[model samples]
Target chain A: MKIIVCIKQVPDPEHAKMDAKSGTVVREGVELMINPFDLYAVEEGLRLKEKMRGEVVAISMGPPQAEEALREVIGMGVDQCILLTSRDFAGADTWATSYTLAKACQKIGDYDVIICGKQAIDGDTAQVGPGIAAQLGIPQITFVRKIDEISEKNIKAERLVEGGYEVISSPLPILITVVKEINEPRLPTLKGRLNAKKAEIAHWGPEEIAADKDKIGINGSPTKVDEIFTPDLSKDGKIFNIEQLDAAAEEIVKKQKEMGLI
Target chain B: MGIKVIKEKCTGCGICFKVCQYGAITMAEKVHTLENGKEVKRLAVIDLGKCTLCSECVKPCPTSAIELKAEAHKFEGKENYKDVMVFAEQRRDEFEEAAFELVGKGRELADKLGVNLYALILGKDLKGKGEKLISYGADKVIAISDDSLFNFLPEPYTNILIRIIKKYKPSIFLAPSTTQGRALLSRAAGKIYTGLTADCTGLDVDSSGNLLQTRPAFGGSIKARILTPNMRPQMATVRPKVFKPLDRDPNRKGEIIEEKVPADLLKSTTKFEKWIEDTTSAISIEDADIIISGGRGLGCSDNFKILFELAEILGGAVGASRPTVDEGWIPYSHQVGQTGKTVGPKMYIAVGISGAIQHLEGMRSSDFIIAINKDPDAPIFKVADVGIVGDLFEVVPLLKEKLKRAING
Candidate 1:
């Protein structure tokens, strides 16, 4: 069971604030962390590796700093990691990003499974995982909440849908995008951290991966953003202070009642 | 490797630096050897590592110094592509509300482009069902009803959609942003080498007959207008409830043709064993008139019970913010935020929610919003109709008691 998990480093959503005046994000003190959902994917990969006794490899396509994210994952028991960083990979939409990642996977050659988070917090597209699977022409079980069964040949998983969950079974060399409900991520052990620090992270660029020049970056990306602007969040709503909690509560109730809203 | 600052065009105005939200842009002092003396010019340098390529900074530059170099893909047989087609996602022979919404929007776009609106009904037992779309707005509905097409396996669904797309080149394609819809359509678009924008809240056909897809990016903090200018079928998945479904007209007539997909192409490596329908979805937050949503301020999972109690009293459904849902306090089905469901209830009571812009995007459309948080400066208060600066554990109970007494009396 050769497990491959894809992760992303994103600005912490809690600290990713906006400058009201400029209508742009305020990034001075914002910190970067592994995309919250991807942690579950990594955890699932680690669990699968522990059960099946194969290597769990983590892959991330980001700037050089994104190597820090891969190192963190390695500290959490991933056998090795790969950092796909290059100027050619900039401005990638889901298609280009997936294409590049898929090409990287092909370069890795032999792999049993590819796991990814349902979606990244920043983009919120949830398109890349399926896009990669599509480019690879492989089976995909997206929004997977749990892995019911697995073996060298096939796997059964529970996928989240609109109303409920669906139990799906797929053959080997499959891709699974997992949601947060999948599992709780484990912390890095002292020994694991030491190993992570000593591990030499493999670096791959377009040339190294044999990526097609036409499908490597922004130029290859089919969709182009014509315009970008901040959403106007300037709604003027009334505010009321609380003196005694009970009195404030009663007033609000009467207010809703008087307004015929209760 | 495209985004760059043209040194010759740059005046060192430093406007792009201020507009860059990613902190990727900085003013670098470059010594320019003038005719008389050396002059230090502050040129804007963009760090590719931090730049998301959102292209926001490009608009504010007076000199048009920054350029994203990419050729608009050219199609050889572009003239052959015609009409607008919608996926018409259905389960158990019943079309989702999103399908109807897409049909209505598709009808509008089709009219604007002087083309037809075609709906694809791909599923099992969809015998008389495809015609329902005609009443809403579809000009033609292609129904691919077969056993292999029953379950929405990504591979099979993608193959079927690709076949239809290849056969009839629609100028535009739309789908619901449901889990199945996103998974299936992304695969289809990728396989076909076309663009597919996700969770678009706005859709319109531009003057050049190009579909202008508008969607939120950066966790709903920013809006992006995307274009698949050179592609045959410009694809996008629309956020549910963003558009209203057109009224059904029995008098309206349209064509409904059943198409067959070869069994080999419909073969799915992924098999669906069972579907445990969310029985609780009957009271889903999307349809609720009053939604009392909790957040991290609720403290822990035990705190959700209060929200449920309040919801039960009001006969409404309980909702949770992204954090609470991500915290596993409640199910993802109850999450009401950007990454979750977009909801517009009559009355939304935010208990302990500090309203991130992402959460606000989903519920800001509510007719009346009441936010209760200890922090008066909480962003939720900014958009809330009634802002209560208090603790939820203390405030929620008293408010519930008063409301319960008033309703009973």
Candidate 2:
């Protein structure tokens, strides 16, 4: 059975900042890293490779520099890397982005399975994976916390719910988006690191994928950001500080009365 | 540099070939001779250049043959301060507190931008609520009232919202971080192809009008402030209880424009299984005027006897951290953190708990925090308004007794 994993490079949210005046993020000088959740997806893929005795491939999309993220995956023992980068692919929303990715998947031809992180931290939409599955016309299971079983044509997984869990199964050519609780990603080894350094990363564009130019980037995207501003929270600005814990119980009741919220 | 293949490590599983979109890789048969002089045939490939380095195929290889390479590069773009808009949720004949809290927040941000505060409300029979929104300081209330919207589903809501957003194009859109809000907003953000910060604790406007959305990230260890440069309608979901609502003015008025929801867009894939009414009348931990929360050091369930008594005396609700819930001392619903609910009570009394980042992320917005733990070094004290280093068992019962005597006298 053949399997594939999709990954993304995102701004290191730790040092990320926004320009209050422009309503845009300051991407320059902000460190970039593989999304945290994608690490789980990579780990799950590697584990599947070990269990099934198959080869693993890493795929990503971004600017030319994002090749570094793919190399990191290569260092973790993935066999190959494919990068989708083009100037025409700018400003794509999840829908257009998913379309580009789905086109890429179709170009790749045959596959038995696909894995992705439940959501990207930078976006936090948790839609791309499912969108890819929808575009592929394949079955999908999301927020998968555990893999119950995997046969040649079927896979069973434990999906996290509000309480307890639900068991779900899907046929082959399926897509699965995973959560952080799924697994701890493995660190790259000395041998894997050396392999990654010597590896050759590949790049693709809309022309190569035969992707519709109209549906590839910002032009293909249906939604647009019209305006951006900070949220306001200037209520009456009331404050009641309780210096003593023993007196807090009474102070709180009185404060609630004054506010009339209860 | 992009992801590369260690052909030597390739298992000929065809996983990478299946993931490659540029068709840059094609499998060919090659014979390998083993030590025993046995010949093995495997799939071999291919040249580069055509590759896009998208990393779509890295995770599926079973033999660990895929990897990603990082390189330093710049994302070219210009900067923006978008407008501020909040989704004013009206359901079950009333407005959700989260919506009001977000409106209060949106109003302040709009003032900072010198822009109009747009409140988007959709529901059945919400015209009366629209006036209250104006009193709360919304510059305008865009109301879409229809029975079809009575049941909050994704398709129609997202479609109509997408239309409104396309027309007005506010800079920032705020939604409450409730299950329903999250369900619709998360998808809506993605459908529109923009950035969304989930469960934000704080929202601020810089001089330029850019939305500063701060939320806990990375299992709650770090606070991440997100900004969507070059993207309009930078979106965020603020947890309930994180902000206060404005005082009501009955005479307040604003422009209330009525919109329509199309019936064709009303269908959804997700079913409404059931609505389990909130069983506990105990004030929502987030709305509680006072909260008596327990930590791991509360010792055991029996030890909470004093906590309950104190909570009852204070006429407030009881809360617990993830640790207490894990220890089986309380139900999981009471757990608060990155996994549980975010709360901001007027006064929060934490007994015998060392606050982890995850736990702190959920309750740091409380008006006043009081921590009582034997360890003075506990992280909870970092944000506590009052810190007492001692045994909670000894201190809580005594504190409760003192409070009761003072009240009775």
Candidate 3:
């Protein structure tokens, strides 16, 4: 089984800022990390590789610095890493991004399974995973919390729904978007870090993947961001000290009563 | 400019009918003689008399059966679209409360736009549920009744919704930002080629008729208002509990249109095996009225038991910060933050939570907030209506005793 994991390098959202005048995200001077959720995907891929004796490849689409994320994943035990970076790929929405990733998958060719985080925190759009599955015409199960069983030909997993969990089974060459409950990601060891430093990172661009110029970036995206502005948070409230804890609790109960909530 | 169904590609999914606010599309059984003299199937038919040529139904046809006769002329301006439509999501044969909440907000937006408010409902044998929606302020209810729709599946649901949008051409579309809603609406929006604002904390229409979608940006440090000025059928997914539902009026009456779904379109690549409800968290954190959440400051997983006990006494639910959940102290379902679940309860009590912006993003909208932390400078105190600068272990036990006595009295 050949398992591929898709990861992304995101500006640490905690420190990420937005340019007020331009209404665009400002990444300068911000710390970058492997999208926290993607760590679980890479770990799951590595675990599956360890169990099934197959190679695990980590793929990421971003600026050149995204190679850092791939190299970090390599240290987590991935056999190979591929970085799909290009100027043409900038400003892509979920559809265009998924299209490019699907094209990269086609270039990679032989693969039994693809894994991705349920959503990227920065975009907060879970569309890319399903969009990739749609583009590849493969079965996809998103919000997967557990892998119940896995074989060379088929895989069964428990995916999260609105109110419950659904156990779904899909054939090989399928895509699964994992949630945080899946497994705890392991830290990189000294030997693993040494191997990561020596590993060769493959770089692929639009031409290498045979991607269409019109469909690889902003031009291919259907939706466009028309405007962005800061929201008003001007409401005022009272704050009390620890000595006033009982009084505050009493006031809250009183307010709840006024609002007809027991 | 009217919508046309390609006979060969028509799957009769009835998504067109479900979305049509004008009741223009209907599923009818048609017999066609094969070359060998065999008869066949039913298809969706469009009534030109009732159709307003909105060209909204073209996208949701599973097989791409529907098309606008003149694509360029179909959407000449925003004037062609009318009314606000809310996707009334259902689960286990019942409507989610968020459905009513969206309808409530839809009602306000529709009234502002001076158009009718329509609720698009899809489910299995949802008899009389349309009436319930009407009581909650839906001017008209378009329902697609099918057994396959009992559970939310992205492909079929998205296809149906896209067809509805193409046929009815609602000016605004609202869906609850739940997991199912996000999946369904995102795919449908992609097919419809429209901009969708996800997890909006606030929604309103500008004087120029553009939907103003406000959501937290850069991890709750700031809120951003996003707009899609050049798009039709403005789409937004609203978080649950942000708005209150209207008072129910059983005496209210509205029109209900029922549509059928084609069996072929229901065939999907994925299959559902079984539903396992998380019995431990019987009430989801999103729906909880009062929430008692703990954070890493609580020390360890065993410390969570006291918070759970406090929650039980308060008749509320237990919630945790992302760190505690990441530490494996609690399940992800109990997490309250940007990555976990956004909640707006009546009252939120934080025990030993340091109030990271990410954590505040989820619970900031709560009506009343009280924070308990030993550190006086914890960020949580900035947003908390009351701050207790004391040890949680000592403060929590005292507060719980006071609450138990108060409730008993």
C-alpha RMSD over true interface residues, model 2: 11.2
Worst 10 residues of 2 chain A by lDDT: A232-241
lDDT of 1 by residue, B295-368 (tens): 99999998888988888888778889988886778888788875666676667899999888778767776767
DockQ of each: 0.54, 0.05, 0.17
Ranking of predictions according to DockQ: 1, 3, 2
Model 2: DockQ vs. true structure: 0.05
| Interface DockQ of candidate 3 | 0.17
What interface-residue Cα RMSD does candidate 1 give after superposition?
Answer: 3.9
Query: Which regions of candidate 1 deviate over 4 angstroms?
Result: A18-25, A241-262, B8-13, B19-23, B34-40, B48-52, B279-281, B286-290, B296-306, B309-316, B322-329, B336-347, B356-368, B390-409
How big is the positional error of residue B395 in model 3, measured in Å on the Cα after superposition? 2.4
Best of the candidates, lDDT: 1
CAPRI tier of model 3: incorrect
Q: How do the candidates rank by lDDT, highest first?
A: 1, 3, 2
TM-score of chain A of each: 0.89, 0.87, 0.89
> Can you write out model 3's per-residue Cα lDDT over B1-409, one digit (the tens) per residue?
2357777676667777754434567888778654566555777888764454334465546688876532121235777777899999887678899999998999999999899899999988888899999999999999998888787777778778877887788989999988888777766765565667777878899888878888764454445566656668888888887888999999988899786667776766666777899776657676678899999989999999998898888778889999999888998978887677667788899998997767876777787888889997776776777677888888888778876776666
